[model samples]
Target: MVSRLGFLGVIARLFMWAFLLGLAVVVLYPLLWMVLNGFKTNAELFGNPFALPTGIDFGNYRDAWNRGVSGYLATSVLVTVTSTVATVFISAWAAYGLTRVDIPFNKVLTAVILGGLMLTPTVALVPLVRMFQSIGLYNSFWALLILYTAFRVPFTTFLIRAYMIDLPREVDEAAQIDGAGRWTAFWRIILPMCKPIITSTVLLHVLFAWNEYLFAMVFTNGSDVQTLPVGLTSLMSKHGTDFPVVFAGMVIAAVPVVFLFLFGQRYIVKGLADGVGK
Candidate 1:
């Protein structure tokens, strides 16, 4: 019976490893193929889709950069950075208030905020467009910034609030006993302690703002304000035959967020676990 149990454990381990290997291939192969294709010429790509490039070349990447990708990348960076800062800080403060402060109708306010998660972005699209246009914000940088920040705040607040709720009230009492005000306590102590979750929310918001398409497309017309998602579409349309350059543009767009997630994945896991677990 002991020998049989050991054999079953070995089988289970092998099965798990095989499953993981398959999953890795499924996730990584397309990315690898994309990068490899970025180095090939159009003829070479059409000639043999799966074959390796004849030689390493940077022309495709250069051409992609010169053909308005640089502008799009800059716009994406601006929108993503500004919106992320707005969303995370606002959410953090809202979370701090909801969890630590004794305000009137606290539960009602919490419900009203978290309830935003149920409000579909598509449902409000028409109204948002009309409002922005009336305010002369349509096809502008601030339009994307305001939209992304507003849409993301509720979810970000929910994540932070969940984590904040698990923290002991004694921390606040301690700060007060030492003659610290609420702002000082939050700025010095609570915010520092909430770093793990804050990192997670920041990463999440970056991903959203970077990859957002519908608003980016609808709100921005000129190449000056268009983001990667919209710019990539325009690239494909304008250079339909130059698939290599298109692939190169995609690789450029994906690299930052991919590297970011790889570096911060541990924080994301820890934050979500601690925030949601309690």
Candidate 2:
């Protein structure tokens, strides 16, 4: 019986490994193909889309950069960084207030904020456009910044608040006893304690702001302020026949977010585990 049990365990282990290997291929193969295609010539790509390139070529990448990818990349980076900072910090403060403060109608406020999660961006598009236009913010960098931050705050607050709720109240009491004000304690104590969730939310916001196409497309008309997602579309249209350059542009756009996820995946897992597990 022991030997039979051991044999079944081995079978289950083998099955798990096989499943993982298949999943990896499913995820990684397309990305690998895309990167490889970026190096191939247009003719080679059409001739054998599945095959590897015959020679390395940086020209396609250079052409992509020179065309307009550099500008798009810069815009994406600026918007992503600034908006991530704004979203995370604002959400953190809001989370602290909702979870730790003694304000009236706190529950109603929490409900109202979290209700934003149910609000669809598409449903509000026309109204938002008119509002931004009326405020003279349409087609501007600040427009994207405000929109990204505003849209992201609620979900970010939810995550941080969940994590904060699980924290011991003693931490706040200890800080208060030490002559620390609420703002000081939050900035120095609770905020630092919530680092894992903060990192996760920052990465999540970065991904959202980096790849956001609808708002970027609708809000910005010029290449100078358009982000990677919108700019990639423009690149494809302008270089419709230059498929390799388009592939290179895609690779360029994907690399940063990929590296970011790879680096912060641990924090993401931990933060969500701690936050949502509550």
Candidate 3:
């Protein structure tokens, strides 16, 4: 009976491994297929989507790069980096204020900030457009930066505040006894402790600002200010017959996000779990 149970356990383990392997394949196959087809010609892709390319075609990448991807990628990097920095900085302070500082109507303020999460972005689109246009910010980089930072602050602040609330009050008290003011304590003590969640927020912001299409399309008109998502769609529209080039462009745009997730996936999981759970 013991031998039979052991045999059953082995079979279960084998089945689990197979299930996980199949899941991995299902998740990875589309990305792999895109990368592979990026190296093929239109004829090759159309003739056989599943087969390997006849040769490594570098032309698609070069053309894709030339056709606005270079400019779009640059703009995307600028917008993403600037917005991520602003969002983290502002949200961190807001979180600190909410969690650490003693102020009147604090709970009301927290609720107000979190209430932003319930607001539909589309509901504000027309008002935002008018506001930006009136302020001379429409079709500008600042417009994207402001919108991204504003929309992201609520969620980012919530995450950081959650993490901050879990920290021991003794640390702040000890810092105060050691002649550390609020800013000093926060910068030297609290902020460092919140690094994991902060990193996760940065990653999330980067991913959103990089791939976001609606705001990018609506806010920016000229080629110089358009991000990768908007620019890539334009590329697709212009070169509809050339699937390989579009695929190559997609691969380029996706490379950074993929690498980021691969490297900091642990922080992402931990931050969300701990921040939300607490």
Candidate 4:
């Protein structure tokens, strides 16, 4: 019986690992296929989608990059970088204030902020476009920047606030006694300690802002200001028959965010698991 139980345990563990591996492949296959096949010609792709390229035909990357991917990539990077930084800063400070301060109507204020999370962004598209246009920021980077920041703020605020609420109050008291004001206490004593979750939040938002397409498509019409995802699609239209070049453009847009997630995956897991239900 002992031998049989041990055998079953080993089998179970193997099965579990195999299952997870299968799931990873299922989820990752398309992205893997996209990147690898990106180097192959249409004829080559049709001949063997799964096989490695016969030779590295880097012209696809060269042509696409020279045409417009570089500009779009730069634009996307600019928008995502600015929006992510601003959002993180604003959300962190707002969360710290919400969780740490004992202001009147605090519950209501928090609820309103959190409520924004539940609201569908699609619902506000029309008014938002008009509003941005009225303010003369539409069809521009500032428009998309503001929209991205606003859309991401609520959830990030909630995430930071949830973690902040669970953080030990003793730290705050000690900071105060040591002559740190509210802002200083948060900056010096608390923010540093929340690095795991904050990093996770930044990564999450970076991915969001990077991949964001609808707003980018809607807000920025010109190739001069379009983001990667939007610009990649536009590249597809212009190079529809050139599957390799289109795929190459897609790969360029996707690689950074993919690597970013993979590298910071541990932080993401720890952030979500940390202080959860505490």
Q: Estimate candidate 3's alpha-carbon lDDT, on a 0 to 1 scale.
A: 0.93
Q: How many residue pairs clash in each candidate?
A: 0, 0, 0, 0
- In order, the Cα lDDT scores of the candidates are 0.94, 0.93, 0.93, 0.88
Runs with alpha carbons beyond 4 Å of true place in candidate 3: 238-240
Report the candidate with higher lDDT, 1 versus 3: 1
TM-score of each: 0.97, 0.96, 0.95, 0.93
Task: Report residue 249 deviation for candidate 2 (angstroms).
Answer: 0.6
Quick one: RMSD of model 1?
Answer: 1.2
Worst 10 residues of 2 by lDDT: 232-241
Q: Kindly provide the TM-score of model 2 when superposed on the true structure, using C-alpha atoms.
A: 0.96
Output the worst ten-in-a-row residue range by lDDT, candidate 1.
Answer: 232-241
Which regions of candidate 2 are displaced past 4 Å? none
Candidate 4 TM-score, C-alpha based: 0.93
For every candidate in turn, the CA RMSD to the true structure comes to 1.2, 1.3, 1.6, 1.8
| lDDT of each residue in 1-278, candidate 4, tens digit only | 99999999999999999999999999899988887787898899888888988887788999889989999999988998999999999999999989888899999999999899988878999999889889888889899889899988999998888888888899988988889998899888889988877998999999999998889888888888899988887765643467788889988888898889889999988887774534
* Top-lDDT structure, candidate number: 1
Give one digit per residue, the lDDT tens place, for model 2 in 1-278: 99999999999999999999999999999999999999999899999999999999899999999999999999999999999999999999999999999999999999999999999899989999999999999999999999999999999999999999999999999998899999999999999999889989998999899999999989899988999999987766643578899899999999999999999899999989988886
Question: What C-alpha lDDT does candidate 1 achieve relative to the native structure?
Answer: 0.94
| Backbone clashes in model 4, listed as residue pairs | none
